[model samples]
Target: MLFYLTTLNLARFLKEDPPFIGEDEIDVQTQQAIDAWKHAEFLCRNYLLNGLSDTLYGVYSVKKTAKELWNSLDHKYKAEDAGAKKFLVGQFLNFKMVDSKNVISQVQELQLIIHGIHAEGMVLSESFQVGAIIEKLPPAWKDFKNYLKHKRKEMSVEDLILRLRVEEDNQGNEKRTLNPNAAKANLMEHDRGSKGKNPKHKQGPKLGPKGGIAKKPKFQGKCFNCGKMGHKSSE
Candidate 1:
């Protein structure tokens, strides 16, 4: 389950509207971390489902080792790793979920991981360090360990209520905009007018003498408004 969730999140990150970073440009260390997480998740899941008790411990150990490897990566390496760093950040949530026995604990841990990832992404000038990231977490999160110990199990309820609330809230805040097709058409029309291609559009008409088109003056004329000899003005 954790493996699937990580895979899905990684896919979404890669497929973002403008893309966070390029996949092909990712560095070796980042790619190694991504592969390690994927392999660890697979081994952990297989060991658990197959009821291989001894192997399960080994799998968990490997998972921890892989996570440590990821956490130790330097900022220069991470930058070169591109999308791999983002992928590894997401894998932290997967790591928390893999061993958690309670839903609340899982959610809280996942939330912390998300917050850390967000902070790391936002702080562009600094190096990403696991210790530094943990240090930056809010006091509320630090106190959550004690809070989780006393928390009761929630009732088994359908998630439809939450879904409906989210939908309604989204609808309320949504902005209406011109359709892309209409916007493209409007832009094209604007460009045509700006380029003087729209025949009926005119800012000034150079009227011809009588029925013929007026010839452009080769030299400056006296201004009609001020009666200046070197300049011409139109009322």
Candidate 2:
């Protein structure tokens, strides 16, 4: 809404205007005054309809003139706007990475929020932003945080963010190098666990060398079946 007004050079009309008196009641007014008033009315009606809520539309709908609606909204909402800016400042101050996001991502998010804080009227210096971001680093990042703090030169917000990205990447490579064996062990353990529930199958009885029963030995001149000495007996 502000941008719209700014582009058209009509922002000042909303913030400042001669005490609006009825056209008929005014003793003397210039042609410029009349034109400004007409444009403000036309733009304000459109702004309220398109930009604001139906509730606000209803609130301003009853006003007989656009100037009255503009003034009324400014008086009522501008005072309430203070709380929103305060909340933004609080968020900027209490920003913490926790463990939910990567270090570089958290820092980038913090940069966006800091920019928003500046837009909301709390301008912070580049050095201050850089220092605040370092301070808010999670406990696991103590070494990097201290390294950033102990730097002799003041750094811009972008510089600090770039350095943080490089540091995070270096740390990731180091972890991969030192723990490759541990990672392999974990994969092996998981594979073993996947088959842990089933029992092993037992082997069946061994097969003979030929696909037939073994031949029995016979005694000299003795019946093999009867085991008696003499002629072989037929059964």
Candidate 3:
């Protein structure tokens, strides 16, 4: 708002007193100057009031001069903005990334805190924001953090976020690849345990080496009825 006023050349009315006309002795140029000053003052004051909310408009509309309204607003909101700035700074300093949460989501949260700080009139460089994000990464990302820190090229916040997203995706793919192998190993171990716990039942009669049932040997000696060397009477 102040910047806009400065651009319009009306900001002087906020700092300068209104022009005075002497009784019965004013030059045409002096009268013109006074009239111009009054017009500018009116514009400046109306602009300020129009920018306010309905509640604030009603509250501050009683101020007759642009300078008074400007000072009152500055006095009120400046202190509030200062307190908000400190809170935002604290939030930024205390932000930490955790392994259980998505890194991109956490980065976004940090970005919001940065935005709040900027809105409160505190400016942070892109490189500083990038460094802060790296420092706040979870313990699992220590090696990656070191790698980023050792790089010679400086990165903007956007570039840093892109790099982090790629790294996170790679890590996710690796974990996905390892999970199936771990599950397979666990399944095999479980199967072996089940087999050990319940041994197989005893098998049926043994078969011949060729996997066929063996026939009984013929009677070599004479049978009781025939008494012959190799024949039985019944046969």
Candidate 4:
């Protein structure tokens, strides 16, 4: 605004208030100046309103001047002093990686906290952030934590997180691949168990009536004509 007003020779209107005796009664000079100021104020209002969310623009839009609107917005978002720094640090300390999402997502959330602290002018070294994240990894990632610690190359936070995301993707693909095979093996075993040995090939008592016949009576044969146990001769 200052730049625009100074370069365009409208600075005086911003510096000194325009005569407000009455819009219709204003002289040509006063009218031109007021018109210029109103135009500039309109542009400024548009700028602020454009940046604000639909819900908040109405609150700051009521300000009478460009400077007041800008200052109000600045104060609303960027709190001055070291107090915000302490708050950001507290957030960083309280952040913990949970197993709710992939390791990459958890790490990204922690990175966001580190970035929030940085945005407050509290600089944290890359290595420090990496170590903090490693320490916060969920219990399931113990082996991965050790693997990262043993790496000879110190990786950037972005690079490490990328690797984590890739590892998670690979793990997911492998699980999908193995699950079908495991299910198939289990199904085959169940089918084999459900089917008994073939009846024709099986070794067991032969099929019979509900109860076997009684033992045959002892055999006795005689010839009636000869009355001989061994033979019968015809007379």
Candidate 5:
């Protein structure tokens, strides 16, 4: 809006009031200057009014001069913008990352909150923003967050985001690699448990030629020295 007003050289009209000269004392030169100023003021006022939304236009259109309209708008929006800045600050401070959501997506949300702060004319340094993001990482990322905090080199927001993406991808790959091994272990444990609980799956002795269970043979030779029958000498 300031640039638009500056382009037309009518920005001064917002700060300066229209020239006042007595009708009885006005000369041709003074009259001409007054008319020119009036025209410029009119253009300035119209520009300001046209820039407003329908709601504000109705409320401020009755302002007679550019200075009046500009002052009124400044008074109204200044407080509103201050309140908006406070709300954005609160959001930034309260934001937290959770394990269930994507880390980069949550970082983007934090970036947007920072953007809103900038739009409100508040400046947040890039290093500060990077630190804030690290501080807000999920509990699952505590080790990585500590590593980031301990780095001696300064990091820009872009660099921080890149590092975060790499870390997130690595973590995801590690989980993918471990999942199959974990499943295999669980399956092995379940098989062992089932075998222990049910004894019907155990194998019995082999069958003989006639399909009867095999048995040990009894001794039939007599012991010569002892003159005993149905018993072996070695027994």
Candidate 6:
């Protein structure tokens, strides 16, 4: 899909009014804009294939609709026509419906396309100084990019701290690696201590004659009936 777009005679399709010449020939910015649109179209195609299972590349159909709609609008209304803009917006929203089932994968791909569109919009808006072209972008696409930028900024301090902590832990672990067997033994010992067992009987303080102050008895007696510890018959 990307190959088809880049290889195709896109300049011919663009139909520049005066026919761009040597210096006016496809500039890098224009090329990037075309590339972004091409990528978006490719993603839209794949999205339709997997989502609708129609096997028809619907992006061309959508573009046809956009072109027809653009032509139908009044020359003065083209830039501000809410109705025409809504048509494009509706198409974008329809494409978004494909995201529900394969959300993670679809979103990942869509995010790339949206980012590309946003970047392209920025270039067009700045390089050509076309506000209307910038406005042509889907509102959701613009919002998504803004949201991503905000989230990135919000995480700056926390991300720095987390990265530093990870680096510190990596250095510390590299300096001293624990033996697996010893680590396993230490874990078992810790577990035993928590289970009311005398893990270090020799090191533990001894019981005294002080009333109720002695270390609790490990066992009272064995039950003859149930064969359980801490129980005795009143014989």
Among residues 3 or more apart in sequence or in different chains, the pairs in candidate 6 whose N, CA or C atoms overlap within 3 Å are: none
TM-score against native, each model: 0.18, 0.63, 0.59, 0.45, 0.69, 0.18
Top-down lDDT ranking:
5, 3, 2, 4, 1, 6
**What are the clashing pairs of model 2?**
none
**Cα-lDDT of candidate 1:** 0.47
Query: Which stretches in model 4 have alpha-carbon errors above 4 Å?
Result: 1-35, 46-58, 79-92, 98-105, 112-123, 140-153, 158-185, 189-235
Candidate number of the best TM-score: 5
Candidate 1 residues 3-91, lDDT tens each? 55365443232122222336877799877767765665555444334433565455444423323323333333577667655775666
For candidate 3, lDDT tens digit of each residue in 60-116?
A: 999999999999999999898888888888898888889999999999999999998
Per-residue CA lDDT of model 6 for 38-134, tens digit only, reads 6654543333244332443343335332223223333435465555455544543454423124323443444444445454342222322112222
Give Cα-based local distance difference scores for all models. 0.47, 0.76, 0.89, 0.72, 0.91, 0.44
Better of 3 and 6 by TM-score: 3
Candidate 2 Cα errors over 4 Å, as ranges: 1-53, 186-235
Model 3 scores worst on lDDT over the 10 consecutive residues at 226-235
Quote the positional error of residue 165 for candidate 6 in Å.
7.8
* Clash totals in order: 3, 0, 0, 0, 0, 0
Tens digits of per-residue lDDT, candidate 5, 1-235, equal: 8789999998999899777778798999998888899998999999999999999899999999999999999998899988898899899889999999999999999999999999888999988998999999999999999999999999999999999999999998999887868878899889989887555577878999899998877777888777777776674
Structure candidate 3, residue pairs in collision? none
Error of 4 at 130 (Å): 1.8
- Model 6's alpha-carbon lDDT is 0.44
What lDDT tens digits, residue by residue, belong to model 4 across residues 57-79? 87877877666666776676666
For residues 23-125, write the lDDT of model 2, one tens digit per residue.
5775545656666677776776566556778777776777655456678878787777787788778888788888557988888788888878877777888
The true-structure Cα RMSD of candidate 4 reads 9.3
Error in Å for residue 184 of model 2: 2.8
What TM-score does candidate 4 reach?
0.45
